[model samples]
Target: MAKASYLAGVALALAAGSALAADLPSRKAPPPAFVPPPPAFSWTGLYGGVNIGYGFGASSSIRGGELLTQVPGAGPFAGAVDVAAGAWNMPTNLNGVLGGGQIGYNYQFSPWLVVGVEADIQAADLRTSQAAGVSYISPVTGAGVTGYANANQYVDWFGTVRGRLGLTLPSWPNLMIFGTGGFAYGSVESAHRYTRFDGSAPLFATQASATTTSTNTGWTAGGGVEWTPMAFPAWSLKVEYLYTDLGSINQVGTGFYSAGAFGGPATMLVTGNQANFRWHTVRAGVNWHFNPFGSSAPVLAKY
Candidate 1:
């Protein structure tokens, strides 16, 4: 009977041990290996964009010209007399709106340094006009002489191919500031008219107009700031300003004159007129970038 009691005690001990083991918390397999996300932004890519902006500070001037007349019996028995000389000083200011598109490629060499090339074309409405007149006594006829002139200048379109250099803040790698310079080309148009009268009677008048569709090549320089957001890694926004000079433009036109003290009528050639073109522009744009190279994943840090 005592042996039986001892075996019962041993059985109870084994049951208690099994229950204790069951009550203890179980071990769980470690969580699946954590994976990091991709980088928030990168400057190395190809981009295309459209821009709209305002243009001001376009300027032009008339260089040189002259007007002369011959009076048959007025100038000590007939000789040509000098009436108008030098240039009609006309300064024009052009201001308007412009819109365009651009394509470019960028390479980020370091955390703060980037280099790139870009090309853009803009259609503009930049036109200006001025009217001026002068009065004097005719040298040969001693008659009252009055002269009036009207001038207009405009630019239809312009383009640029440029190189870019930029720097970024280490604390904010997504924001960049840059300077750009390169080749520029454009089309320009101009027109002018001059009329003269002697003693309330029309003496002579001339009209000259020219359209230069051929590309005028020059230089351009500017600077800008660009920003990219972590939420939209493939896109950026920018604001920029640029100055372009297209050099000088030459224009020629025919002049029709009515004979004064001389005779019936005459046609004269007018030359040696020039207009210089310089423009300034400020623009804002958004760009969409594409990854030509393979993607690189980024690390994650819990806040």
Candidate 2:
């Protein structure tokens, strides 16, 4: 019985020690499995690009100005009875080339999405020309004669401010597609002239010239793909295309009179004819982008 009690005590002590050992601090949990964070997207920063595209423009009509008609045949009556007409109609169909540069900044909200603001300007050489004639009748002399003249002008140049939304394609190396829209303002300039005849005689051959500039504000929208074909050490090259529509403008002819030269001032009329114009543009360009937000530099790959 004494020997049995001794064995029991020893067993009890061993069991208690086993319990304490089980409660002791566990092996430092193996360091959490090494896990690298997801790759960071590259979108933040500054960029610049040069664009070239064929530009086609519609004809701009004249509006809001007075067109004057003088009767050479009226003689003294010509000065008093001369009739005046506002721009009956303006000419349209100006075509030209568009070339320019663009600059912008961007912020990325996620690995695949970004937003930005951009501005670009382009110069064009689109123009049109027209001619017309009028006959004047004298109330007193009962005589009439014809006066003739022609005019030419152009509509070219534009600038805009816009917002851009884009998505990065992970499958494609350093490639993104974006859409943009914004407001733009621009103007077109044009000129015209006319001549007068005195009854049976060539009264002083009178000529007139005038130029009107029309400004308008309108909306622009377009989308394109950008590629970083040569990316190395945080730098990449991009090529993109975009389309825009800069709505319409109203044109007015101010007056008519005798002018000696093409650009010289002519006789002034208080009123003129009115017309409207609409325009569209397309462009292709190259850009340089740096990804300061990403751990790795861009890889230049073309699609």
- TM-score per prediction, in order, is 0.80, 0.59
The TM-score measured for candidate 1 stands at 0.80
In model 1, what is the error at residue 163, expressed in angstroms? 0.6
The most accurate candidate by TM-score is 1
**What tens-digit string does per-residue lDDT give for candidate 2 at 1-303?**
999999999999999999999999988756676555644447678887778776554555544333334434432334333344442454665566777788888777766887899898877665666665556553434556455545565658777789999898666636778898888766666566555544443344554555667766676777777665433424444444444444443333344444221122234342443334455566677766555454344454554
Give Cα-based local distance difference scores for all models.
0.74, 0.59
Q: How far is 129's C-alpha from truth in model 2 (Å)?
A: 3.6
Q: The CA-based lDDT of model 2 is what?
A: 0.59
Worst 10 residues of 2 by lDDT: 259-268
Per model, how many backbone clashes are there?
A: 0, 31
